[model samples]
Target: MARSARPVVHYMATRPDGTVPPTCNHLARYYSGLGETIPTVNLADHIGETVDHPSPGEKWYTDKPFSYFHMYTRPGEILERLEVEERWPVRLWEVEPLGETGNWGNDFAPYWLMSHQIRVVREVEAWRAFGHRGMQVLATLAQLPDLARQWTEEWTADPEGTRRTYTAWEKRVDHTRALTGWAFCRAQYSRREAGLQAANELAGNAAAQAATAAGADPHAVALIQLRARCLVAGQLMFDRIRTGEYEQSIRGLLLGAGLETPAPALA
Candidate 1:
């Protein structure tokens, strides 16, 4: 017996709200490099082409073809709906399997597994930018304790005027940390003396632990921590893009870093 001819269909994933996610767009660009441009189509418009129109509950299938690249936005929620709503066992009789499908963006290693020439360089550049910004924020956070100590010494020398200055400085640090999601050592001390003492202790403890963890130079340990934080932030940004929240993710990062959100470039 011979295998049935694979269907020539192309499937793309969309957000739960029926909007196309950036990941799908990036993947489509990747496919375009292969010489075939897959145009977006509504299942309602393409009724009776090869498959019946998807039901109301299957709104996730809007503009979707019968390929492996399914479920781009909020995949976790969609998969849960599939299991609970009894929407699984979907028809794939005339569908063609092109590439590894399912939830993407948990890890970026798979994206780079393909040939370098055809790899999506834009995604890579985006990831690099995310990671670099994350590192800069983390590096500043790590120095907060030291800055607190310096402020404390200055306060002791000139308690009257330095009190006002120190309070303003603390507020700025708190604001920065809150924006960047790094509010581990928030300024909760009502009195300057108490805040300074707490900050010094916290700083010393953090330095000791970092040194012990790496068992090397403290500078090297700091770099390693910065790199790890950047990688995690990049991974999270990718996941957000997969879920069709590219603007929110990118804009939040820019705002957190005290940067202006640039106008969208002409397409």
Candidate 2:
């Protein structure tokens, strides 16, 4: 049978000044213990030759016979070898008991990516909860302006402290977005209500003239006109809140409220 191809892996090399990522030497030594020799290549040599050239500080391995295929071929063999070499203890309960086991530094790339995704999901959930709360509290059209003022006051009173407390970027953005949304809602509701009132008044005037001609009661016409206005106002408010023009009014509102624009979070 033909020999299976060896696996090629890479790690950051120990620098001339003797500085290196801790995991680099650990992984190189592990593969060396498995009877493989590692190699070093200067990235500058291949910079113009290949698009996917090696990065600086990278060391390459071309002689390692150990592969994922070998892992399954003899189940427990690699773990037994590791334990026998005294490099890793065979503990059943604890994963990564010997700390991080990758070529990268202490901040594992995979875990960092996963944590960022989790934070994004949490921020989205928080925004949804905020929107639901806004719907519950904004019972009347007149409350929108008041609520907006309240948010502005709360934000301005402690802008820096609030930003520091909500360190997440999404949380800060969501706060400004929510305030802009309320302002837009108030403006849209007022515009729609005014238009509807004008139209309703014209129709009411025509109806009142017709009812007078037909000798119908003026008091009943007046009651119907009042009910129409109330119905239109309520429906307009609800529709405006649901489908208001949500624009990027963050800068304007921040300045207007005498609050500084929120800075981006540090990496």
| Winning model by TM-score | 1
Model 2: worst 10 consecutive residues (lDDT sum): 113-122
- RMSD to the true structure for each prediction, in A, is 21.1, 28.2
lDDT string, candidate 2, 63-162, tens digits:
2222111111111121222312222211111001111122223342211100000000000111111122222212322233333344334434665553
Q: How does candidate 2 fare on TM-score? A: 0.18
Q: Clashes in each model (backbone N, CA, C under 3 Å)?
A: 1, 0
- Looking at model 2, residue 114 earns an lDDT score of 7
Deviation in angstroms for 10 in model 1?
22
196-254: candidate 1 lDDT, tens digit per residue: 22222333344445444434344433422332332233322332322345434442432
TM-score of each: 0.22, 0.18
Q: Clash number for model 2?
A: 0
